[model samples]
Target chain A: MAKKKSESSVSTVPSPASSRAAGVAPSHTDLLRQMLLIRRFEERCAEAYALGKIGGFCHLYIGQEAVGVGAISALRADDYVISSYRDHGQALARGIPPRTIMAELFGRVDGCSKGKGGSMHLFDRNINFLGGHGIVGGHIPLATGVGFAIKYRGGDQVCLCFFGEAAVNNGAFHEALNMAALWKLPVIYLIENNRYGMGTALERASAINDIAERACSYDMPNEVVDGQDVLAVRDAVLRATQRARGEHTPTLLEVRTYRFMGHSMSDAASGTYRTKEELEEYMKRDPIIVLRTTMEKNGEWSDTAMTALDEELKAVAQDAWDFADASAEPAVEALTEDVYVW
Target chain B: MPVVTYRDALNQALQEEMQRDDRVFLMGEEVGVYQGAYKVSKGLLQEFGEMRVVDTPITELGFAGVGVGAAMVGLRPIIEFMTWNFALLAMDQVVNSAAKMLYMSGGQFNIPIVFRGPNGAALQLSAQHSQAWESWLAHIPGLKVVAPGTPYDAKGLLKSAVRDDNPVIVLEGEMLYNTKGEVPAEEYLIPIGKAALKREGEHCSIITHGKMILVALQAADQLTKEGIRVDVLDLLSLRPMDVEAITASVRKTNRAVVLEEGWEIGGIGAQVVDYIQRECFDDLDAPIVRVHQVDVPMPYAKNLERAAKPDVPKTIAAVKKVMYLDQ
Candidate 1:
């Protein structure tokens, strides 16, 4: 695989400049803020995990913040979002508040799922954020069904489905995509190609290198975006959303990015399958750094202002931690609640 | 009252429910153009159009999960497995996705979906295609499992399941589809978690569900000829079982027998026995006995298949054993 040395790729799809011309002016400052919020929140999550405040397979979204922010930034408020277990980034990107998410990770009653669901299963009916399903490739078909319901009721809403590159080899993914394309369901099948399915690399698991190209088998239109470039990610999603709303079509999007941290808190970032040199190579093109540099070149931002915003986001994360610390654990009687509805 | 086949009664339920609610739709491999494998959905595609009466490709897990997802967002999807045997491929979606979605999502989402098809042995279907699924699905916490032996209960209970706010599994007897029974002309729904007395007596209580209810009734007839009058209780639903009705009948008769179409090892009968021992222990006159399928995969030969499954003679034998008449 030819890794891009530059921090950002020049997208062949509509660029950020082209989007501005097309009357879809994206708020770059807000995008950067959202990405930074996720980054800071996850940094705190890592700290809490290390302190044993949070337990059970906590995955940090340190490097892959741009994909969640940019893609989610393109959707309407009514549009739905569903993803795999590594989902705190997507939940934050979907505008679920930091405090409620933190409370959920702490297993408190104030969490989004009322603490019934933990970190991997955050859900909010009000915002249309379906959930972060635990099983790999499990929620893809659920997203397809959301699209099916939308079309059935004669609505224009689109659902964004997220999973890892490793899930492409799973049967559920193929089954969902085939049905979505065949029925022209309005869903965006987004694969965050962070290169590894847990400990194993994609090349060792999947039969082919071009993950998006496999969309050809289902006859679905496909796109590959520079995952670190938030603007590039937004443009690809905007085009796909347009197709979804207008033609009731589904798109397969491959966002190639790198996971700066380990698969989860249990593993080390440097040892085993990935080397320190590889991590260093990817760090130079860090999404946060890339976006800040672009804003600086455009005369829209400065290093001092960026530092202030970073501190503000960190404070917000710190406040969430405080809120989570004081929140009460769920009542024992809640065990039998919500299991059935008549 | 009007006479109807069990298949036609199920079809009437689907048609009536689809007419009542726009959220109700049917999806499976042959539910649309093929009009259902057993013709349970005949004339539905023409009434509701292809979009509602959908024909999915041969992906059980995928389509089953899609039904759960649709149900999450407030669409009532009726996913018909070609048969209960084929549904094995989609058990993960049924059990993991549909069954747990409401509980896992903290009540944020409820899957109002039904998975129905011909279940149990259908004449020499061999080992792979002739298994009963009541015990397997009833064990799940957030799901409702119903198996009706009569056409009236078939139509009524199906309508009830369609309107339910949770996932339900409707296990229709494959052999009972062609059987005819009286059904009401007006709309009615048989509530789940209730048992119906198919036959009344005083000597003993013969408990059963699904197709075994028919064999139990037949045994009751034979026992009556032998001067042993028994009560035949058809357990309509398996999960929220009618414990009150069960204990009431056992208290009156002081003897009981359970007949099921599934295997004996930890089957639905075991749960019934547990409830009996706990609730009606002092009222019993003799030990309870269960009549079930033989502990082996279904055989191919006609004679072997007949011997493997419980018949009227086996049900009678079980009733007699519970009556303290070993002969």
Candidate 2:
């Protein structure tokens, strides 16, 4: 690997705010822009899936956009993030282009993963967005080990692992948390407690109910945050990120939120476990609405400006879809490709 | 030629591979300071330190997932399951995560890892710890399953597995750990998907793997003394099974018997029979006979446990049945 002068000096992140939670704070406009991007990107994904443009299992982050936007907004570019299948928002928030993501959903040759990984499988090493793991609680240990890599390499990088509240009951969750806490690895376990685990209500499914409380068994600091509030979620993640890098301790955060969409494309949102009214009730506290109301109250954004921003994002999303739609399918020869060193 | 036990050959392979490449390391329950309950990873922690040769907490899913991640990030890891029976706990990580990473990642990540340990019944280890999991693992497409019976294949295949660019499950025989055999004194790698011929003959073919290969070989020798020639073929790699080798041998011998130490019901032998029937059914003079372990929970008594699994007598009986020796 050659380290040329141009390549070495070329920083991975453009905005200084993309690095640490340093003195270079992001403007309100930048915050709103990134948040809107994630929201619109996921909305387009859902629509594309409905149009039969996307294939495989698709888990949309429709109502839970702020969880990824706020959490990722608080970290440095060097910090790694490992999340579960509902990761379109995280990928968009982490600066992966909507075009590449859309192409991936379309299984196109131009996709980020070259049509190999569909909805549930996404990876971008350059941005350090590890993957959209299909298996429940599978990537928890991997995130812990990534934190170990940072510490081993003698860097201050932290790893933020995100999983649904359902993963808390898995054996891997317990095993990974114990190891991370025991090693004092710089990792933060974020639980997006959306009150439902694939049609099963959290209250009925989990005996403990409070996922954060599970972290106390490992003697790790646990925090519960309202995931719909962007600033609050950002503040909580920033605090945990600081503790992880500074004190060398792992923290578990229970982000109280809800998903408007079903577990996957095949799942119908309206079902026996949850009512339409419950879904509508969660929509009232939607992360996008919370951010928009906050910005309106502070006079940081106006309805006219918001409308214009929405129009711009709509154009971008439309362009992304068109770009993905026009992209060629992978070659027939590619079917037997990438299995091994062949 | 150097004489080494099957267990020592595996340990030497791990040590040599770890020394040859910094990326290679071992992680399991007591692989580190505990020196492995089986004592296969003895002196590893002292030699490689806690960073490389790690003693993970009793967390099979966690450590296996960690190994998958490490492999994704350019490290070759050998995850030990004290026994393959315990791997049931980490099945998701092995089957869903490690096996599917390359395909799932759209080819961005290839997990060059090996999950190795003892697999079948050795003593009265009983139901929980004595069952063979090769059939279950071989069911998945993205995985490569290897079961080496001899010290030479154990060392060579392990070295190849450590360096190969895919996930492999190396199922070693627990009872054969102390069995000594001659091994070469140079670095060699037996490629995956290659079968080895333990003995050559023309009358009938015996296809088996792992510890069953020894049993089959003994049966072949006994039959040879009785003036009946038997070709003994060791199907080391179970997934990309040496179907061509077995088919070619059966086409020549015109009769075949599949032997396995696992349960007869839906075992690796059943899979081989299906493959052989599809590939060389026309060449068969007699129906393919499969000698497999009795399908039942291995009892806690030594005699019952030995009786439950396929043995030399069972192999000889199956061969005799195929050869029409009763007449």
Candidate 3:
């Protein structure tokens, strides 16, 4: 596996000089492919919700595809990842089978969490995706502890804890970061600053706009990146992860991003805090569109190949939906199982 | 038989358990370097090294979650809080993850972790440092709550807790750690959800556990001198409590006195008495009596603290009242 190091190098596409330096790649085709998969999957979830198929609190990871794919693309398969309730895109980007994720959403026996955890508690142990914790910032400390375990067991695994900008105000967020920095744990605290935390915009809640600067309080290095640009997000994570693995130093990455969807499937897009015009402006910087334009210019992608991958993804997503829909609910006796180590 | 202090028995139980199972390990504040707050885990670090007998930083939540995660995998982790009072910092991990993980995951994950430490009023340790949290833990369905009174029960129960596949909270009384008793030098397993009969009688059943067990035993001896045969039963586990033993004793004795060191209103003793009344209401010769500390903070002075806690005199009076001896 070490001999395939060169083959594992991150892909590239051309972008603006400023963007390129920050790690924005020109590979619009690949970026668009990932963004489309997430968008279509979430759209299907929204449809499922309307049809009364998926129950429990379902937090869709729609316009936040770039933060997950761009950042996750920089990580190795062995590295661990944990995220908050808005976790579907991250799980997908980390290579979890869509069928398992859909099954979890559908509350089927075949789900990643075996139907025990619906939308809020998605857990895929195989992909090293710890969970989709329902608590606001409950899993932050958990990620830091896992990082400590990785270091303690003498492993090169880095833990990426993805939380929202709203979590910056949480006591756990501060407490976990301080402890992580103090212990010099191999972790990257990725705050996907998507402006809104649930219903409230972050500006209305957080006293500090730049969460990356908060890392300074713990004497850790911080970086601010364009979350919309997959390449840029990847670059920031690559450097931070390298430092975490090499020097055993923790890094904080504040990815400035926006979520095009409401907090949940039920929430309307219209709101007092965000204007339609502002939403449109951010949509112009849609990660998929930016990547696609770059790929077209770089000649790394063609319309035919893009079309083929799009069809392939749609078919795969449909298969996932069918598999989840056809799967049976767990047995009634299973309700009392796994409570104790009997 | 070996004369062992309650503290040494607990240390031996932990040491023996660690040696017996590779997955069994201890994690706490001073459990490794300083031995333990009460020296209950002394000298095990040298034998097991840092891996098994881990000395963690004072981040209760962090270590507690780690214990939960480790238990979720294959390891059986024994989490020692400096005192059960400090476990409040990790209550979410215990209550939410360790206790409810099985039910919430639809029975996919069973947490085989033990959260053990001294619990309840310990001298003048102050209000913040001393508490009886067994009732709070017992309220949860999945957690097994145990509080042992004697050296034998403590060693046997602690070993059982370590071996149990479910999360168990073993509440060791701080004052009872030094109390000495004869412990058998052989492997023994104490099944959870079982009660122990400390003394045999027929007049009135005295149901109690932990520190109050001593009080009940003393009260039985005193009552025997007065021609009152008081049956004493030590409740080892609070959850999945021995309802059968309690109800059967209450039926046989025809009267009862429930004793506990916690506040009188919502104590484990109250639960025992309630269960007896609910299960065997027709068998009562007299109304049930609850002997507990007055509803007040444990005082600092030794006399005041003793006055606030249930003692042999209080237990004797409660037994007499329940058996109609005064009548």
Candidate 4:
């Protein structure tokens, strides 16, 4: 948890907009700042989990930052988003305050779910971020239903559902995809294929090597994009969202990324399942570094700017930690509230 | 008053609610084109159109989860399982998603959804197809469960459950669907947590819900011939249970007989027994007795099925035992 150095070397690179790619958002600085803030916030979470400040299954979004930043960047604020448990990155990118996410992780009243839902289940209705669900593939059908509601009401809004590669084999996934396809619901099913379902590798779990090909079973369009590349992920998601909004069709997208940390804090940097060489290989394509290197090479970023932004975000994470630490546990009487709405 | 089948009453409730609100829609297998497997939704597809009266594949969990998701975004969905037995596949969405969404979201989203369908044994369906789901479904804290035995209660409870602003399980009586009852020709809504006095008496109280109301009434009739009058209380809703009504009935009669169509252990009768013991123990003149389906998988043979099922004779015998009429 010390100050980390930049991993990507600066070279000639194209700007986000020029390649007609999902490259970067309109502002290079903002995209860089957003992804870095998530990195810093969750690094603190890892530290807290180690110290027992945060409990339960805490999964960090350490290495796979670009997929969240760029994909969410393509979505309008009105669009709905639902994610699996490794959700701090997407929640932060969706513009939910770092303090709220941090507080929820700490199990405080100020948390989005008022501490009723700990690390796994985070919900914010105001921003249309549906939730961070716990069950593996259980939420895919829920997302498809959100799309059904949107279409039923004739609303142009779409939903982006995030899940891991591990969820593909689940019956819920297949069933949801089939319905989403049959009904032409406006949902973007984004698979963050970090290559492991806990300790089991994707190759061991799935029959097909290409996760996006599973979409063919439902006759849905799909894309396989570089999850490490902010622009590429954004571009693919932007196209998917366009298809969703304009045509009311669903798309399945596989964002190939890697989890730098173990699946959860219970497992360390995952040396048991993976090798140092493989870990180093994925570490080189780290999302933050990939985006920063491109921007710096384009003369849109600098070492001074990166250092200043890093400090600012670190303070933000610290303030969030302080807020969560100061917030009280939920009142005892609240135990029975919200079970039913009279 | 107009005499109508329970299925017709339920149909009227769905038609009225859908006509009243644009957000309410029905989704299930065979609900639209086939007009419901039990014909509970007959003529609905033609009236409401295919969009509102939807038919999904045999994906119980898929459609059920879809209903939960749709409900989260402000639409009121009525998800019908073909039977309560098939709802086992959809319990994940019912229990995990619809029931817990509000609490888990810190009270942000109230899943105003209703899961409705026929429940309990019908003839000799036996085993997998025949299950009285009230006990298991009622166990969930976030869900409001209701079982209506009469046509009047069915119409009113289904209408109310659609608007309850929480996940509700409407355990419709499969056998009672074809049975005729006098329903008032006017609008009415039955509150989800009250019991109805089907027949009032003095010697004892017979508490039941759904189809067991008929058994309780029949038993009460024969008991009257034996100079043993009893009060038959029909518990329409299980979760926001009408404990006050139960206490009043048990306190009045001084003896209680619980009748249900489900298994004995951890049954609805057991919960009622717990409530009665805690509330009306001193008032009781005799130990309470329960008449429920025998503690075994429903047998397929006609004789074994009739023996396993709790019928009017079982109810009468249970009441007589509590009243000390039969040694």
Instruction: Please give the DockQ score of every candidate, comma-separated.
Output: 0.79, 0.57, 0.38, 0.84
lDDT of each: 0.89, 0.84, 0.81, 0.89
Name the better of 1 and 3 by TM-score.
1
lDDT of 4 at A103: 89
Candidate 2 per-residue C-alpha lDDT over B80-190 given as tens digits, one digit per residue, 9 for 90 to 100: 998888899899989888888777677877888899999988888898988888999988878899999999999999998898889999999789899999988887899
Residue A272 in model 3: lDDT: 63
Ranking by DockQ: 4, 1, 2, 3
The TM-score between candidate 1 and the true structure equals 0.95
Grade the docking of candidate 2: medium
Interface RMSD for model 1 amounts to 0.8
Model 4: CA > 4 A from native: A1-25
Report the lDDT tens digits of candidate 3 across residue range B54-82.
77777787678767756754578899998
Residue-wise lDDT of candidate 4 within A180-297, one digit each (tens)? 9999999999999999999999999999999899999999999999999989998999999999999999999999999999999899785788998899999999898898789878
Please write out the lDDT profile of model 2 over residues A1-342, one tens digit for every residue: 111223222222233235344645555566677677767767778788888889778998888877887898888877888889888888877777777888989999888778888776778877777888887888898888777666555678888889999999988899998988887889999999999899888988788977799998999999999998878888999999999999879999999999888888788887678889988888999887888788778888787887766666666667678778999999999887777664
Q: For each candidate, what TM-score against the reference? A: 0.95, 0.93, 0.88, 0.96
DockQ of structure 4: 0.84
| Regions of model 1 farther than 4 Å from truth | A1-25
RMSD of each: 5.7, 4.9, 6.3, 4.4
